[model samples]
Target: MPKIFSLFFLFVLLISCDEDVLPKPKAYLSLEYPKKSYKKLPLKRPYTFNVLKNTTIIDDKNNWLKIKYPTLKASIDITYRPIQNNMKELLTEAEKLVFKHAVKAEQIIPKDFVNTKNRVFGSLYEITGNAASQLQFHVTDSTHHFIKGSLYFYAKPNYDSILPAVAYIKSDILHLIETLEWKKSI
Candidate 1:
Protein backbone atom coordinates (compact mmCIF):
# COMPACT_ATOMS: atom_id res chain seq x y z
CA MET A 1 0.00 0.00 0.00
CA PRO A 2 2.86 2.47 0.86
CA LYS A 3 4.70 1.74 -2.37
CA ILE A 4 1.53 2.31 -4.42
CA PHE A 5 0.89 5.67 -2.70
CA SER A 6 4.48 6.81 -3.40
CA LEU A 7 4.11 5.87 -7.11
CA PHE A 8 0.84 7.75 -7.33
CA PHE A 9 2.45 10.86 -5.79
CA LEU A 10 5.39 10.63 -8.22
CA PHE A 11 2.96 10.35 -11.18
CA VAL A 12 1.10 13.48 -10.02
CA LEU A 13 4.38 15.41 -9.73
CA LEU A 14 5.37 14.35 -13.29
CA ILE A 15 2.00 15.46 -14.66
CA SER A 16 2.31 18.84 -12.95
CA CYS A 17 5.81 19.35 -14.38
CA ASP A 18 4.51 18.58 -17.87
CA GLU A 19 1.82 21.20 -17.47
CA ASP A 20 4.48 23.89 -16.93
CA VAL A 21 6.10 23.31 -20.34
CA LEU A 22 4.47 25.97 -22.49
CA PRO A 23 4.68 25.75 -26.26
CA LYS A 24 6.91 28.34 -27.89
CA PRO A 25 5.34 30.72 -30.40
CA LYS A 26 6.18 30.05 -33.99
CA ALA A 27 8.69 32.33 -35.69
CA TYR A 28 7.80 34.01 -38.96
CA LEU A 29 9.25 36.29 -41.59
CA SER A 30 7.06 39.30 -40.99
CA LEU A 31 6.97 43.04 -40.57
CA GLU A 32 4.59 45.28 -38.63
CA TYR A 33 3.76 48.93 -39.38
CA PRO A 34 2.08 51.58 -37.30
CA LYS A 35 -1.02 53.52 -38.32
CA LYS A 36 -0.64 56.18 -40.99
CA SER A 37 0.88 59.27 -39.44
CA TYR A 38 1.40 61.62 -42.36
CA LYS A 39 2.71 65.15 -42.08
CA LYS A 40 3.17 67.96 -44.56
CA LEU A 41 6.45 69.69 -45.37
CA PRO A 42 7.62 72.40 -47.71
CA LEU A 43 9.62 71.82 -50.83
CA LYS A 44 12.86 73.64 -51.46
CA ARG A 45 11.94 74.14 -55.11
CA PRO A 46 9.38 76.85 -55.70
CA TYR A 47 8.50 75.41 -59.10
CA THR A 48 6.08 73.03 -57.43
CA PHE A 49 2.77 73.87 -59.09
CA ASN A 50 0.79 71.55 -56.86
CA VAL A 51 1.25 69.20 -53.96
CA LEU A 52 -0.73 66.19 -52.85
CA LYS A 53 -2.24 66.70 -49.39
CA ASN A 54 -1.91 63.16 -48.05
CA THR A 55 1.47 62.54 -49.62
CA THR A 56 3.43 65.38 -48.05
CA ILE A 57 6.37 64.63 -45.77
CA ILE A 58 8.35 66.76 -43.35
CA ASP A 59 11.73 66.08 -44.95
CA ASP A 60 12.73 65.97 -48.57
CA LYS A 61 15.91 64.05 -47.84
CA ASN A 62 13.82 61.10 -46.66
CA ASN A 63 11.35 61.40 -49.49
CA TRP A 64 9.25 58.36 -48.80
CA LEU A 65 7.20 57.42 -45.75
CA LYS A 66 7.98 53.81 -44.97
CA ILE A 67 5.33 51.30 -43.94
CA LYS A 68 5.98 47.77 -42.81
CA TYR A 69 3.45 44.93 -42.81
CA PRO A 70 3.92 41.57 -41.19
CA THR A 71 5.15 40.06 -44.45
CA LEU A 72 6.23 43.09 -46.44
CA LYS A 73 7.36 46.73 -46.49
CA ALA A 74 6.53 49.78 -48.65
CA SER A 75 7.25 53.48 -49.13
CA ILE A 76 5.54 56.33 -50.96
CA ASP A 77 7.56 59.31 -52.17
CA ILE A 78 5.81 62.45 -53.33
CA THR A 79 7.33 65.37 -55.23
CA TYR A 80 5.67 68.32 -56.91
CA ARG A 81 7.01 70.97 -59.21
CA PRO A 82 5.54 73.73 -61.33
CA ILE A 83 6.14 73.69 -65.03
CA GLN A 84 9.47 75.41 -65.36
CA ASN A 85 11.85 75.47 -68.34
CA ASN A 86 11.01 72.83 -70.95
CA MET A 87 8.88 69.76 -70.25
CA LYS A 88 11.21 67.52 -72.22
CA GLU A 89 14.22 68.87 -70.39
CA LEU A 90 12.57 68.31 -67.05
CA LEU A 91 11.63 64.75 -67.98
CA THR A 92 15.13 64.09 -69.16
CA GLU A 93 16.49 65.31 -65.88
CA ALA A 94 14.06 63.05 -64.04
CA GLU A 95 15.12 60.09 -66.15
CA LYS A 96 18.75 60.80 -65.37
CA LEU A 97 18.07 60.59 -61.66
CA VAL A 98 16.26 57.25 -61.96
CA PHE A 99 18.84 55.71 -64.25
CA LYS A 100 21.75 57.00 -62.19
CA HIS A 101 22.05 53.70 -60.34
CA ALA A 102 20.85 51.44 -63.11
CA VAL A 103 23.08 49.49 -65.41
CA LYS A 104 20.48 49.88 -68.17
CA ALA A 105 16.89 51.00 -68.65
CA GLU A 106 14.98 47.85 -69.48
CA GLN A 107 11.64 49.36 -70.43
CA ILE A 108 9.34 52.37 -70.10
CA ILE A 109 5.53 52.04 -70.11
CA PRO A 110 2.92 54.77 -69.96
CA LYS A 111 1.00 54.59 -66.72
CA ASP A 112 -1.97 56.95 -67.16
CA PHE A 113 -3.02 60.35 -68.29
CA VAL A 114 -3.23 63.19 -65.78
CA ASN A 115 -6.08 65.28 -67.23
CA THR A 116 -6.79 68.29 -65.07
CA LYS A 117 -8.40 71.65 -65.80
CA ASN A 118 -5.01 73.17 -66.56
CA ARG A 119 -2.79 70.41 -67.99
CA VAL A 120 -2.42 66.89 -69.28
CA PHE A 121 0.47 64.38 -69.33
CA GLY A 122 1.37 60.73 -68.72
CA SER A 123 3.89 58.69 -66.70
CA LEU A 124 6.07 55.64 -67.46
CA TYR A 125 9.33 53.71 -66.85
CA GLU A 126 10.74 50.31 -65.94
CA ILE A 127 14.37 49.72 -65.04
CA THR A 128 16.19 46.47 -64.41
CA GLY A 129 19.55 46.10 -62.71
CA ASN A 130 21.96 43.60 -61.33
CA ALA A 131 20.59 44.18 -57.85
CA ALA A 132 16.98 45.20 -58.47
CA SER A 133 14.30 46.43 -60.84
CA GLN A 134 12.28 49.64 -60.52
CA LEU A 135 8.91 50.68 -61.90
CA GLN A 136 8.81 54.44 -62.19
CA PHE A 137 5.99 56.83 -62.99
CA HIS A 138 6.09 60.43 -64.18
CA VAL A 139 3.08 62.73 -63.79
CA THR A 140 2.59 66.16 -65.25
CA ASP A 141 -0.20 68.66 -65.33
CA SER A 142 1.59 69.38 -68.67
CA THR A 143 1.83 73.17 -68.44
CA HIS A 144 3.93 73.75 -65.31
CA HIS A 145 3.62 70.85 -62.92
CA PHE A 146 5.47 67.55 -62.97
CA ILE A 147 5.73 64.76 -60.42
CA LYS A 148 7.78 61.61 -60.73
CA GLY A 149 7.57 58.50 -58.57
CA SER A 150 9.39 55.19 -58.45
CA LEU A 151 9.07 51.98 -56.48
CA TYR A 152 12.45 50.40 -55.74
CA PHE A 153 12.81 46.97 -54.19
CA TYR A 154 15.94 45.63 -52.57
CA ALA A 155 17.24 42.59 -54.36
CA LYS A 156 20.28 40.40 -54.53
CA PRO A 157 22.85 40.89 -57.23
CA ASN A 158 20.97 38.21 -59.15
CA TYR A 159 17.60 39.96 -58.79
CA ASP A 160 15.96 37.12 -56.87
CA SER A 161 15.46 38.41 -53.35
CA ILE A 162 13.47 41.42 -54.55
CA LEU A 163 10.49 39.37 -55.67
CA PRO A 164 8.76 39.25 -52.31
CA ALA A 165 9.03 42.93 -51.55
CA VAL A 166 8.34 43.98 -55.11
CA ALA A 167 5.01 42.16 -55.21
CA TYR A 168 3.87 43.78 -52.00
CA ILE A 169 5.19 47.24 -52.76
CA LYS A 170 3.31 47.37 -56.04
CA SER A 171 0.01 47.20 -54.20
CA ASP A 172 1.01 50.06 -51.93
CA ILE A 173 2.00 52.14 -54.91
CA LEU A 174 -1.35 51.52 -56.52
CA HIS A 175 -3.06 52.59 -53.33
CA LEU A 176 -1.11 55.80 -53.38
CA ILE A 177 -2.12 56.48 -56.94
CA GLU A 178 -5.76 55.89 -56.14
CA THR A 179 -5.65 58.29 -53.20
CA LEU A 180 -3.66 61.04 -54.90
CA GLU A 181 -5.12 64.55 -55.00
CA TRP A 182 -3.57 67.73 -56.28
CA LYS A 183 -3.15 70.35 -53.57
CA LYS A 184 -2.52 74.03 -54.29
CA SER A 185 0.68 75.02 -56.02
CA ILE A 186 3.66 76.19 -53.99
Candidate 2:
Protein backbone atom coordinates (compact mmCIF):
# COMPACT_ATOMS: atom_id res chain seq x y z
CA MET A 1 0.00 0.00 0.00
CA PRO A 2 2.82 2.48 0.86
CA LYS A 3 4.70 1.60 -2.40
CA ILE A 4 1.55 2.24 -4.52
CA PHE A 5 1.04 5.61 -2.79
CA SER A 6 4.71 6.65 -3.51
CA LEU A 7 4.50 5.57 -7.19
CA PHE A 8 1.34 7.65 -7.80
CA PHE A 9 2.88 10.72 -6.12
CA LEU A 10 6.05 10.40 -8.26
CA PHE A 11 4.00 10.12 -11.47
CA VAL A 12 1.89 13.20 -10.54
CA LEU A 13 5.03 15.26 -9.69
CA LEU A 14 6.75 14.32 -12.99
CA ILE A 15 3.68 15.17 -15.10
CA SER A 16 3.03 18.49 -13.29
CA CYS A 17 6.68 19.59 -13.76
CA ASP A 18 6.35 19.65 -17.57
CA GLU A 19 5.85 22.97 -19.46
CA ASP A 20 2.30 24.22 -20.05
CA VAL A 21 0.80 23.87 -23.54
CA LEU A 22 -0.16 26.99 -25.50
CA PRO A 23 -2.35 27.58 -28.56
CA LYS A 24 -0.56 28.29 -31.88
CA PRO A 25 -0.26 31.91 -32.91
CA LYS A 26 -2.72 33.16 -35.51
CA ALA A 27 -1.42 33.66 -39.09
CA TYR A 28 -2.42 36.30 -41.65
CA LEU A 29 -2.29 36.19 -45.45
CA SER A 30 0.62 38.13 -46.95
CA LEU A 31 0.19 39.51 -50.46
CA GLU A 32 2.94 41.05 -52.57
CA TYR A 33 1.97 43.42 -55.41
CA PRO A 34 4.22 44.40 -58.32
CA LYS A 35 5.42 47.92 -59.08
CA LYS A 36 3.33 49.74 -61.70
CA SER A 37 4.69 51.41 -64.83
CA TYR A 38 2.18 53.69 -66.56
CA LYS A 39 1.99 54.02 -70.35
CA LYS A 40 -0.54 55.87 -72.52
CA LEU A 41 -3.39 53.73 -73.81
CA PRO A 42 -3.41 53.61 -77.64
CA LEU A 43 -6.96 54.45 -78.58
CA LYS A 44 -8.87 56.75 -80.92
CA ARG A 45 -11.61 58.43 -78.96
CA PRO A 46 -12.77 61.75 -77.56
CA TYR A 47 -10.18 61.31 -74.77
CA THR A 48 -7.05 59.30 -73.97
CA PHE A 49 -5.21 58.32 -70.79
CA ASN A 50 -2.46 56.16 -69.33
CA VAL A 51 -2.84 52.66 -67.90
CA LEU A 52 -0.76 50.29 -65.80
CA LYS A 53 1.73 48.13 -67.64
CA ASN A 54 0.42 45.05 -65.82
CA THR A 55 -3.05 45.31 -67.38
CA THR A 56 -4.28 43.95 -70.71
CA ILE A 57 -6.78 46.16 -72.50
CA ILE A 58 -9.56 44.07 -73.98
CA ASP A 59 -11.07 45.88 -76.95
CA ASP A 60 -14.63 46.78 -76.00
CA LYS A 61 -17.45 48.17 -78.11
CA ASN A 62 -17.13 51.77 -79.34
CA ASN A 63 -14.77 53.64 -76.96
CA TRP A 64 -15.42 51.39 -73.95
CA LEU A 65 -12.74 49.10 -72.52
CA LYS A 66 -11.98 46.56 -69.81
CA ILE A 67 -8.60 46.91 -68.13
CA LYS A 68 -8.02 43.44 -66.77
CA TYR A 69 -5.53 41.90 -64.31
CA PRO A 70 -5.95 38.19 -64.77
CA THR A 71 -3.43 37.20 -62.09
CA LEU A 72 -5.35 39.14 -59.49
CA LYS A 73 -8.77 38.21 -60.88
CA ALA A 74 -9.83 41.84 -61.13
CA SER A 75 -10.90 44.24 -63.85
CA ILE A 76 -11.77 47.87 -64.34
CA ASP A 77 -14.82 48.26 -66.58
CA ILE A 78 -14.81 51.55 -68.49
CA THR A 79 -17.83 52.95 -70.31
CA TYR A 80 -17.84 56.02 -72.55
CA ARG A 81 -21.03 57.96 -73.02
CA PRO A 82 -21.31 61.03 -75.21
CA ILE A 83 -22.45 64.16 -73.41
CA GLN A 84 -25.07 65.81 -75.68
CA ASN A 85 -26.62 68.42 -73.39
CA ASN A 86 -27.20 65.69 -70.78
CA MET A 87 -24.24 66.09 -68.45
CA LYS A 88 -26.53 66.41 -65.41
CA GLU A 89 -28.31 63.15 -66.12
CA LEU A 90 -25.07 61.31 -66.82
CA LEU A 91 -23.48 62.60 -63.64
CA THR A 92 -26.55 61.58 -61.64
CA GLU A 93 -26.39 58.06 -63.04
CA ALA A 94 -22.71 57.83 -62.09
CA GLU A 95 -23.50 58.94 -58.57
CA LYS A 96 -26.30 56.41 -58.31
CA LEU A 97 -24.03 53.63 -59.54
CA VAL A 98 -21.66 54.31 -56.65
CA PHE A 99 -24.28 54.96 -53.99
CA LYS A 100 -25.91 51.61 -54.73
CA HIS A 101 -23.05 49.97 -52.84
CA ALA A 102 -23.76 52.06 -49.77
CA VAL A 103 -25.68 49.21 -48.15
CA LYS A 104 -22.50 47.13 -47.86
CA ALA A 105 -19.86 49.88 -47.85
CA GLU A 106 -18.61 51.25 -44.59
CA GLN A 107 -18.02 54.62 -46.24
CA ILE A 108 -17.94 56.21 -49.69
CA ILE A 109 -15.21 58.83 -50.08
CA PRO A 110 -15.32 61.14 -53.10
CA LYS A 111 -12.16 62.78 -54.32
CA ASP A 112 -12.79 65.52 -56.88
CA PHE A 113 -10.24 65.89 -59.67
CA VAL A 114 -9.83 68.65 -62.23
CA ASN A 115 -7.11 69.48 -64.72
CA THR A 116 -7.73 72.60 -66.78
CA LYS A 117 -4.94 71.82 -69.22
CA ASN A 118 -6.49 68.44 -70.07
CA ARG A 119 -10.06 69.66 -69.65
CA VAL A 120 -10.68 66.52 -67.52
CA PHE A 121 -12.87 66.77 -64.44
CA GLY A 122 -14.43 64.07 -62.29
CA SER A 123 -15.08 62.49 -58.90
CA LEU A 124 -13.34 59.33 -57.71
CA TYR A 125 -15.14 57.24 -55.14
CA GLU A 126 -13.19 55.01 -52.76
CA ILE A 127 -15.68 52.59 -51.32
CA THR A 128 -14.43 51.01 -48.11
CA GLY A 129 -15.74 47.78 -46.55
CA ASN A 130 -16.86 44.51 -48.10
CA ALA A 131 -18.54 46.13 -51.09
CA ALA A 132 -18.77 44.64 -54.58
CA SER A 133 -16.62 47.46 -55.96
CA GLN A 134 -13.71 49.06 -54.16
CA LEU A 135 -13.32 52.01 -56.51
CA GLN A 136 -15.32 54.00 -59.08
CA PHE A 137 -14.88 57.26 -61.00
CA HIS A 138 -16.41 59.46 -63.72
CA VAL A 139 -14.47 61.83 -65.95
CA THR A 140 -15.87 64.24 -68.49
CA ASP A 141 -15.03 67.38 -70.45
CA SER A 142 -18.47 68.60 -69.23
CA THR A 143 -19.64 68.93 -72.83
CA HIS A 144 -18.31 66.25 -75.15
CA HIS A 145 -16.99 63.11 -73.41
CA PHE A 146 -18.07 61.14 -70.37
CA ILE A 147 -16.06 58.20 -69.00
CA LYS A 148 -17.35 56.03 -66.18
CA GLY A 149 -15.05 53.46 -64.55
CA SER A 150 -15.55 50.88 -61.82
CA LEU A 151 -13.22 48.27 -60.29
CA TYR A 152 -14.56 44.78 -59.53
CA PHE A 153 -12.91 41.66 -58.18
CA TYR A 154 -13.72 38.36 -59.86
CA ALA A 155 -13.82 36.66 -56.44
CA LYS A 156 -16.36 37.18 -53.68
CA PRO A 157 -16.05 40.54 -51.93
CA ASN A 158 -13.92 40.34 -48.84
CA TYR A 159 -12.28 43.70 -48.08
CA ASP A 160 -9.44 42.40 -45.93
CA SER A 161 -8.57 39.53 -48.22
CA ILE A 162 -8.52 41.72 -51.37
CA LEU A 163 -7.19 45.01 -49.93
CA PRO A 164 -3.66 44.62 -51.34
CA ALA A 165 -4.99 44.12 -54.86
CA VAL A 166 -7.40 47.03 -54.47
CA ALA A 167 -4.70 49.41 -53.29
CA TYR A 168 -2.42 48.42 -56.16
CA ILE A 169 -5.19 48.89 -58.77
CA LYS A 170 -6.44 52.13 -57.22
CA SER A 171 -3.09 53.79 -57.94
CA ASP A 172 -3.44 52.89 -61.61
CA ILE A 173 -6.88 54.48 -61.73
CA LEU A 174 -5.49 57.72 -60.28
CA HIS A 175 -2.75 57.68 -62.90
CA LEU A 176 -5.38 57.29 -65.61
CA ILE A 177 -7.29 60.27 -64.25
CA GLU A 178 -4.20 62.43 -64.01
CA THR A 179 -3.08 61.65 -67.54
CA LEU A 180 -6.52 61.89 -69.19
CA GLU A 181 -6.54 64.32 -72.15
CA TRP A 182 -9.55 65.30 -74.22
CA LYS A 183 -8.84 64.97 -77.94
CA LYS A 184 -12.50 65.95 -78.65
CA SER A 185 -12.60 63.70 -81.75
CA ILE A 186 -13.51 60.03 -82.05
Candidate 2 backbone collisions, by pair: none
Q: TM-scores of the models, in the given order?
A: 0.51, 0.84
TM-score of candidate 1 against the unseen true structure:
0.51
Predicted candidate 2 versus true structure: per-residue lDDT over 85-128, tens digit per residue: 99999999999999999999999999999898888899999999
RMSD of 2: 2.9
lDDT by residue (1-186, candidate 1, tens digit) is 999999999999988886566799998666443334332234444232333333324345423332223333334455555566788887887777666646554444445655565354655555554424466666766665677776643323343445445555555555444444455532
Distance from true location, Cα of 9 in model 1, Å: 57
Q: Superposing every Cα of model 1 onto the true structure, what RMSD results?
A: 9.4
lDDT, candidate 2, at 16: 95
Candidate 1 segments whose C-alpha is farther than 4 A from its true place: 1-58, 61-76, 99-120, 129-133, 153-158
Winning model by lDDT: 2
* RMSD of each predicted structure: 9.4, 2.9
Q: By summed lDDT, which 10 consecutive residues of candidate 2 come out lowest?
A: 28-37
